[model samples]
Target: MRLNLRTIWKMIRELSGDDAYERYLKNFHKLHAHDEQHECDTPLSKAEFFKQWQDEKWQGIKRCC
Candidate 1:
Protein backbone atom coordinates (compact mmCIF):
# COMPACT_ATOMS: atom_id res chain seq x y z
CA MET A 1 0.00 0.00 0.00
CA ARG A 2 1.20 3.51 -0.77
CA LEU A 3 0.82 6.67 1.37
CA ASN A 4 -0.23 9.11 -1.30
CA LEU A 5 -2.69 11.99 -1.17
CA ARG A 6 -5.39 10.10 -3.07
CA THR A 7 -5.06 7.10 -0.82
CA ILE A 8 -5.24 9.27 2.29
CA TRP A 9 -8.26 11.10 0.93
CA LYS A 10 -10.04 7.83 0.15
CA MET A 11 -9.35 6.59 3.67
CA ILE A 12 -10.77 9.77 5.14
CA ARG A 13 -13.88 9.46 2.97
CA GLU A 14 -14.38 5.85 4.03
CA LEU A 15 -14.07 6.74 7.70
CA SER A 16 -16.40 9.74 7.34
CA GLY A 17 -19.11 8.02 5.20
CA ASP A 18 -18.39 10.44 2.36
CA ASP A 19 -18.00 7.73 -0.28
CA ALA A 20 -21.03 5.78 0.84
CA TYR A 21 -23.02 6.60 -2.30
CA GLU A 22 -20.24 5.42 -4.54
CA ARG A 23 -19.92 2.22 -2.60
CA TYR A 24 -23.66 1.71 -2.70
CA LEU A 25 -23.78 2.23 -6.45
CA LYS A 26 -20.97 -0.23 -6.97
CA ASN A 27 -22.68 -2.85 -4.93
CA PHE A 28 -26.02 -2.18 -6.54
CA HIS A 29 -24.60 -2.64 -9.99
CA LYS A 30 -22.73 -5.76 -9.01
CA LEU A 31 -25.86 -7.25 -7.54
CA HIS A 32 -28.46 -6.04 -10.01
CA ALA A 33 -26.74 -5.25 -13.24
CA HIS A 34 -28.65 -7.99 -15.05
CA ASP A 35 -31.68 -8.48 -12.90
CA GLU A 36 -34.99 -7.15 -14.14
CA GLN A 37 -37.48 -8.07 -11.50
CA HIS A 38 -37.98 -4.72 -9.87
CA GLU A 39 -40.00 -1.77 -11.11
CA CYS A 40 -37.24 0.79 -10.75
CA ASP A 41 -34.27 -0.38 -12.74
CA THR A 42 -31.93 2.42 -11.77
CA PRO A 43 -30.46 3.14 -8.38
CA LEU A 44 -31.46 6.10 -6.26
CA SER A 45 -30.07 9.54 -7.04
CA LYS A 46 -27.27 10.98 -4.90
CA ALA A 47 -29.61 13.28 -2.99
CA GLU A 48 -32.22 10.56 -2.55
CA PHE A 49 -29.73 7.97 -1.38
CA PHE A 50 -28.24 10.25 1.25
CA LYS A 51 -31.64 11.41 2.43
CA GLN A 52 -32.81 7.84 2.86
CA TRP A 53 -29.56 6.84 4.49
CA GLN A 54 -29.81 9.62 7.05
CA ASP A 55 -33.45 8.91 7.71
CA GLU A 56 -32.71 5.26 8.37
CA LYS A 57 -29.86 6.20 10.66
CA TRP A 58 -31.72 8.64 12.91
CA GLN A 59 -35.31 7.51 12.68
CA GLY A 60 -35.11 5.23 15.70
CA ILE A 61 -34.16 5.81 19.31
CA LYS A 62 -30.57 6.26 20.44
CA ARG A 63 -29.24 6.19 23.95
CA CYS A 64 -25.95 7.48 25.41
CA CYS A 65 -26.07 5.69 28.72
Candidate 2:
Protein backbone atom coordinates (compact mmCIF):
# COMPACT_ATOMS: atom_id res chain seq x y z
CA MET A 1 0.00 0.00 0.00
CA ARG A 2 1.47 3.29 -1.09
CA LEU A 3 1.23 6.21 1.34
CA ASN A 4 -0.05 8.47 -1.39
CA LEU A 5 -3.27 10.49 -1.07
CA ARG A 6 -4.98 8.70 -3.98
CA THR A 7 -4.29 5.33 -2.45
CA ILE A 8 -5.76 6.43 0.89
CA TRP A 9 -8.89 7.85 -0.74
CA LYS A 10 -9.47 4.72 -2.78
CA MET A 11 -9.15 2.55 0.29
CA ILE A 12 -11.64 4.66 2.21
CA ARG A 13 -14.14 4.65 -0.64
CA GLU A 14 -13.97 0.91 -1.00
CA LEU A 15 -14.24 0.06 2.69
CA SER A 16 -17.02 2.60 3.22
CA GLY A 17 -19.57 2.43 0.48
CA ASP A 18 -20.12 6.00 -0.68
CA ASP A 19 -23.90 5.98 -0.06
CA ALA A 20 -24.45 3.20 2.41
CA TYR A 21 -27.17 5.00 4.35
CA GLU A 22 -29.17 5.78 1.26
CA ARG A 23 -28.99 2.15 0.26
CA TYR A 24 -29.90 1.05 3.74
CA LEU A 25 -32.88 3.37 3.80
CA LYS A 26 -34.11 2.03 0.51
CA ASN A 27 -34.00 -1.48 1.83
CA PHE A 28 -35.47 -0.38 5.12
CA HIS A 29 -38.49 1.10 3.43
CA LYS A 30 -38.90 -1.92 1.21
CA LEU A 31 -38.67 -4.33 4.11
CA HIS A 32 -40.86 -2.21 6.32
CA ALA A 33 -43.77 -2.85 3.99
CA HIS A 34 -43.66 -6.49 5.00
CA ASP A 35 -45.85 -7.44 7.96
CA GLU A 36 -43.38 -9.97 9.33
CA GLN A 37 -40.60 -7.45 9.90
CA HIS A 38 -40.50 -5.28 12.98
CA GLU A 39 -41.87 -1.76 12.83
CA CYS A 40 -39.38 1.10 12.96
CA ASP A 41 -39.37 4.77 12.16
CA THR A 42 -35.61 5.10 11.64
CA PRO A 43 -32.22 3.65 11.08
CA LEU A 44 -29.07 4.28 13.09
CA SER A 45 -27.33 7.61 12.64
CA LYS A 46 -24.40 7.77 10.23
CA ALA A 47 -21.56 7.64 12.74
CA GLU A 48 -22.93 4.85 14.90
CA PHE A 49 -24.14 2.80 11.98
CA PHE A 50 -20.83 3.07 10.17
CA LYS A 51 -18.85 2.21 13.27
CA GLN A 52 -20.84 -0.93 13.93
CA TRP A 53 -21.00 -1.87 10.29
CA GLN A 54 -17.25 -1.70 9.83
CA ASP A 55 -16.45 -3.44 13.08
CA GLU A 56 -18.81 -6.30 12.32
CA LYS A 57 -17.12 -6.93 9.00
CA TRP A 58 -13.75 -7.64 10.64
CA GLN A 59 -14.69 -8.95 14.07
CA GLY A 60 -15.46 -12.59 13.28
CA ILE A 61 -13.05 -15.33 12.22
CA LYS A 62 -12.79 -15.00 8.47
CA ARG A 63 -12.67 -18.02 6.22
CA CYS A 64 -11.11 -16.42 3.17
CA CYS A 65 -7.83 -18.27 3.27
* Candidate number of the best TM-score: 1
TM-score of every candidate relative to the true structure: 0.68, 0.52
- Each prediction's whole-model lDDT (CA): 0.86, 0.74
Instruction: Output the worst ten-in-a-row residue range by lDDT, candidate 1.
Output: 33-42
lDDT of 1 by residue, 1-65 (tens): 46698899999999888999999999998888676785556889999999998788787675666
Q: Considering only N, C-alpha and C atoms within 3 Å, which residue pairs clash in candidate 2?
A: none
lDDT (0-100) at residue 48 of candidate 2? 80
Give me candidate 2's TM-score against the actual structure.
0.52
lDDT measured at residue 12 in model 1 versus the true structure, 0 to 100: 98
Q: State each candidate's clash count.
A: 0, 0
Residues 1-65, model 2: lDDT tens digits: 45698788866875678666667778877888775567676777888877877788788786776
Once fitted onto the true fold, the runs of candidate 2 whose alpha carbons sit more than 4 angstroms away are: 1-16, 36-38, 61-65
